[model samples]
Target: MSQTIAVLDFGSQYTQVIARRIRECNIYSRIFPYSVTAAELRKANVSGIILSGGPSSVLTKGSPRPDKKIFQLGVPVLGICYGLQLMGKLLGGDVAKSDRREYGRGRLTIKKKGRLLKGLPKSIKVWNSHGDKVTALPEGFEPIAGTENSDYAVIEDATRNFYGLQFHPEVVHSERGDDIIKNFLVGVCKCKQDWKMSNYVDQAIQDIRDQVGDSRVILGLSGGVDSSVAAALIHRAIGDQLTCVFVDNGLLRLRERDRVEQVFRDHFHVDLRVAKSGKRFLKALKGVTDPERKRKIIGKIFVDVFEDTVKKIGDVDFLAQGTLYPDVIESVAIDGNPAALIKSHHNVGGLPKRMKLKLLEPFRELFKDEVRALGKELGLPDEMIWRHPFPGPGLGVRVMGEIKKSYLDTLREADAILLEEMKRTGYYSKVWQAFCVFLPVQTVGVMGDERTYDYVIALRVVESVDAMTADWAHIPHDILQIISNRIINEVKGVNRVVLDISSKPPSTIEWE
Candidate 1:
């Protein structure tokens, strides 16, 4: 943690990806607003600065721009996309809208093996998503690489240790992206690779102890990686001072309550209280069909029920959640830029309002994979650590249209079958999320010579590094056939099963 790389966010969706890439190199990194001053960065003791790409055009007036003094900070500065254009504009160079905008894959031909492009090939594939390009290089700047459309795709001022790229190297679609980032971190910035998950664990435990001195903490343990790890870490820091509440909301998957009870209560010996409030949640959710309405209803009811349970459990000082960085970034607009709010996280800002308790979120700065690693480091079993992410609204969102007792039962059974077959076929751990979305529409089918109309289940299985982007997982036809057959026959769900073959852009992983 001694040497840090600071990423300046300009409302880019891939801003977190840049931070994640730096962390993957065992170098600590943090994100700041585009308005962060050089004095602030100097106080942060940043070894290098990375300007993130955004959906902004540098040619537009009032577009997002960083403090001009950052160029004088003397740290190695790497600008990307809009960042690159911003640099060219601010540093006495010309930036204009490209006649041929590069939005997808492009080839970068290295003109010089500068320190920023050290060890890279003469030509490499890159992922581009920019409309503006640097037309003229600033003083003391030279082009190190060029794409077919962008003559100054990569520009560098070696004297000032400033570099720019018109393409994003943090995305996986870019070949050798990690190497380019590594070159910047180790080759140019000279960052010490000393950060580790073990260091984070030790630091987090001590931080929890410091933050909650002699105060009892209450955690809503959903048995997911984030909460589970938070519980384990907090419990390790202050034994018996943590009380975990697992609410059976009638919308969870098959036997989720039992699994949670066994793992936390029986195995881990956590102070877990199960509030058998399934009927209450179901009643509140009855006749609700809109996804947003379902989420809000469930969140409000959960907070109400959770607060009631807390009243019975005695006085609590703090409320803990397993909120990760994506949730934080998505909820809050980056410096009031045009990132736009995606959705409010149920575990983030909801409970704190009604409960009126101090919030404790240890994983707020962490990513999903980082939380899983922390869970594993904290001695959580592989099954729980690698569990596919479940929506905060639980199966409430998964059961698409209305909330009904019979629909819940049917969806739960069908989802369980899908998971069972996935595990059997070794596809469970292979995908990021695998679930069944219960479609309210019924279809005609012939079952045992009887014409019947029943519910249809849409199977969504996606592969993703981060939930920001995902592609449908390509399970073999044979395995899919087995899953479809099992769900149709073993589970009493109505007739048909369909696979979602769409990617993330046009279609989301969830139907609703």
Candidate 2:
């Protein structure tokens, strides 16, 4: 069925931000490629269309463009930044490179009011990241708003229900962004608030069945929300054909082993294999301290372990992954924009050339929150579904220096205590990520009137919507005191405890 709003992505970093803002207005929104047709959007029952901004210029050779048929669908269409330029250029308007590009917050003044901009501030801050601007308005379109840098900042044609903006209102930094989106969703398009997470389950199951008909599949069960939910959906589709391999890299949290076996092996009853390769992984990572090298080593080991397991189960046709949109954006190029590579997430799987298993990742189009909602629809336990984000490298990347069994043990216990205290003080769910980092440096401390030196453990916690940006979470003093005291007294080979007050810009959550 059609949605209340359909956003066609042209590889913008803020594409997800647009979908999120619409949801904040209590309306349903889904994203599709710029190649999506008006027929597809109509089949989805879309009431409105949004063109997301991208890094590419409309004048660039072979840049992405929306389907020509979308414009003729006669729905209320809103365009942003590059989106605005694309619409105007395609519909008999002139577009060119601006001599002075607007790249940050600027003032937007209303030249005329429309239903979309109604009840909005006459002047408000808006974010801009575009080098190209519409030089001439499209036929039948008139200017509705403008900034100092661009004359036709916002244009609209009420007769055709077309609107365009030179700035992004989806960004949180944009003033009155929420109200602007509300006016578009509720006042302009009149979308009904009728999307439920649970409504997606049955459709997903049917799609899975159609894709994996009688074919054997191997799933990499990471115990994270994405993989677990993907496994559940595939299990429902192919039944006994799915085999999940769980490798214990010795970098996992306290009792992580028990939890994996209990949940997947015992409860879900999917074919689960637990490869106890902790000793081998530790030995391989003994002298590696560079963060990039550590991630590469772990990723290689994971593939090797998984490849070996797949050989044991002969003739698997597909390798199922839980790849998300964030993962893809960081790892690979899309829409001709070669993104800088981020961490080598172990979940990003490419089997050896010798192993010929096709990739099957159903969650590739979704973000983390959408995956969590799917987890809920699959009837996953709250604790398993809502667990704080864990890195694929486990504690291997958490430790500051070279990996060691001793360091792994100490870090695990300290992190467990941190988790416990967080839950006790009701901070576990409040913070995005809270964990212990084993600093390589040691400080002198007095114990029982004797001076001693041992490794220091730092507690780092932060809150963020997406892990891209974050701020230091201000933990309560009492809870901090209790956590610090317990770690020092209980965890051995540790003398002092410290708190990390640095945010993401200055410091990442991990020590390594």
Candidate 3:
């Protein structure tokens, strides 16, 4: 097993973020449900323990809680938000629904010096999202930190190696959150900061080898980073035992199908099977103008094709996927709190129920950037690592109204021109994601004496940490003008160009 820090998840949306932050500090961490027993955790060789925040109040019945034996494990424990409340309740402390609730940004003032707050300022900003607060400290525990609203903001039992924080230090808003976590891991837990992408690659390959001993695994290669990285990791483990299926759904970017096939079969030397099912995908998608319907149809059809290919290959016992962290996080509502359902990722949402093969998701815990790091470690080209995020439905979603080859071709050319100019101007690497949407509406424009009614194209670029939220990238007007002029002149059927100013909450990264 990999050297790991186990996070007992209480269904907090930010649980994964906490794990990601620990990994960012060069420590390997995995998340388990709060119901996980001490024996199960011990079997995983947990070097440290973290109790993640949850949506439910600790006072509520049936709310998740960790096993009592966790405290007696002689391992370091850190709790955040609801995890802190649960710790307080279990350790003979008082927890109550705060009359004055604290959410968003708050100040955490360190009242007493402790290892968890060492190397930090006397007071620091922290991100908070809790309705309840610890009213009283547990026996043998002292309050190390507090905010104006929360007296028991942070509590610790140095003798027991347990630390609890009322606010979230995992998020970016918590200025010194990472520093606090680092201090706890090194100073208190004595955990070595040895985790890295290279280490992960080595360990993942070994894990895959051990799990699939002589069993064949077939993976669907979507040419996106997730599937590509997953396929590469499996290939590194089992070599010829792994067969990659790259299905051409006809909705990919211009010439992406060929590029994907060549990259895997020729460039990477991975065993690859290319199935051109563009006609079938388009056929299932014919006359589907509704965005959600288009996505569902495409998802269903892709699964059908992939499952058929797996059966044809025969002897496949495992189905591998490039399912990433955000894909998992957005699917389920954390802590029983309602979270907006973002677009259903094809690989994640399109899985066939009761498949004959078991599932293998190596990148399930990795964020997008971390996946890119693993890709680089696996020797994938820089172009693949830096490629823009593409929706699983592909150009089917880029075109707003109907599915047609002509519309897809036009959008493809315009998008290519936009990307080419961004790369040429050295701005491609600066922007997190940049793409073009083919608007269904057409506008009249005059060229010399002739009037033409054609499609309008909208360009979007955003800067974001996770695709969960984003800000519109501020490209210079001169750059935008160049892209707009080039698209209108070079790409036929597009007469007007517009820039998307909305951010993620109001508008998703993709137009659909």
Candidate 4:
């Protein structure tokens, strides 16, 4: 078994990404809050501890602080960003408000050679996002690295197995960041990288068996990869004790409903209950024009429909969902209150409160790509494993204005053609997410000297590590032209096509 590391989150937006990096090193990891007790940490048998950066400044009154007993655990501890400042303040150091706040990329120079900086270059570019800087070093800790603005950049307390870095190494902009984390896990903590997808599958099977025993579990399959993999894992664990309930909200793509039922029933040999609630969902979303309201309505209806299905299928003790790490991080509020909901994350926020079933989220710590890797490890089909992420509300939110079957069908056909052409050109695997959004506006266009007015379709493709920030994928002009021509000629009701060039901060992935 691989050694387990516990990452204590301070409500940072990048907490999940930090855990993902550790898993990428082939090591098992879990995330907890700063308020987690030392006894709880001991129960996990954590070989090492990591403190995640938070959005709050350490000098503030209401800022989160870790359990002081964590340092007494006598295990290796690494802190990043705000975590570094917290360690400094708790251990006889000074952290003052910075006159110059660093929000993006910067260079750091390593002054001393230590185990953490062993394989890294002398000067490395790193991602920094912090308002305060460590002005003084804690006692028994030496500064290993520093930037021109901050002298106490990287501090290490070898005696206590404590390390802290001012820069965020979990992000990709910090190129050698993974190596730095590996040096701490392997060299400093001496942990073996034995964790893999197969190990996760075996452990998850056992975990499910132990938790459920003979109890029944009802999982909601969304036809997306996450829920599909979750259902398969649960079925493998307890066999007939698992029953899958799939709800068709009428917002899915063309033939998605049939494909979902066929894949689960025929290929996986799992018990599936298909509920067609298209009319109910469309009825609830009749005249709702607000984007957030549309999402909430769809989410509420999904829960109600799911609960009704569960009642019909005997008694179920658990509800299994495919809630990934990004979902959690994005939904987490910066205020450090677990009860405080951010956006209505249909899986994490909406269902748990309304339904009485116990939650079972196996992929809570895994990122989107990591979940796909686990899906492949379990022998899932390529189409299911590599499918682009569709939101819980589906294209209902993407339509922008009203709910209509005709418009949705047209959008789905255009999207299918776009994906097919991208796959043929070998660009499907390269982009993070690519899809078609049906615009509420229409324009006049000529198809052989005949003027016609039809709906305009917008294409969006973005590349991002986490959904927090993204850049528009630079698709080839030839490919874009082909996609545009095909949508205009093949898919009816769409006269003009346009590509979205906006990034994430200024624009969301979906038009809504």
The numbered model that scores best in TM-score is 4
Off by over 4 Å in 2: 23-28, 35-47, 67-69, 96-100, 185-190, 334-342, 349-353, 505-512
Model 3 Cα shift for residue 82 (angstroms): 1.5
What 10-residue stretch in candidate 3 is worst by lDDT? 331-340
Model 1 TM-score on a 0 to 1 scale: 0.90
Clashing pairs in 2: 1-44, 2-44, 2-45
User: What is the full ranking by TM-score, best candidate first?
Assistant: 4, 3, 1, 2
Model 3 Cα shift for residue 127 (angstroms): 0.9
* TM-score of structure candidate 3: 0.93
Model 1 per-residue lDDT tens digits across residues 1-512: 56889999888888889999998999988888899889999998999999999888888888888999999989899999988899999999998888998989999999898788888889999999988889999999999899999899999999999999999999998988899999999999999888988988887888899999999899988988888888989999999999999988888888899889988887779889988888998988888888777878888888887799889989898888888877765664633655756666567554556577788888877888888988889888898889998877888888877888898899989988899889988999999999998888889998898987888998999998777788999999999998888888877856999988999866766665
> Candidate 4 deviates by what RMSD?
2.3
The predicted structure with the larger TM-score, 1 or 3, is 3
Give the lDDT of residue 375 in candidate 3: 90
Error of 4 at 167 (Å): 1.0
Model 1: lDDT equals 0.87
lDDT of 2: 0.83
Candidate 3 has an lDDT of 0.85
- TM per candidate comes to 0.90, 0.89, 0.93, 0.94
| Better structure of 1 and 2 per lDDT | 1
Name the candidate, 3 or 4, with the larger TM-score value. 4
Instruction: Please provide, for model 3 over 361-433, each residue's C-alpha lDDT reduced to its tens digit, 9 standing for 90 to 100.
Output: 8987778888888898888888888887787788988999788888889999999999999999989999889
Clashing pairs in 4: none
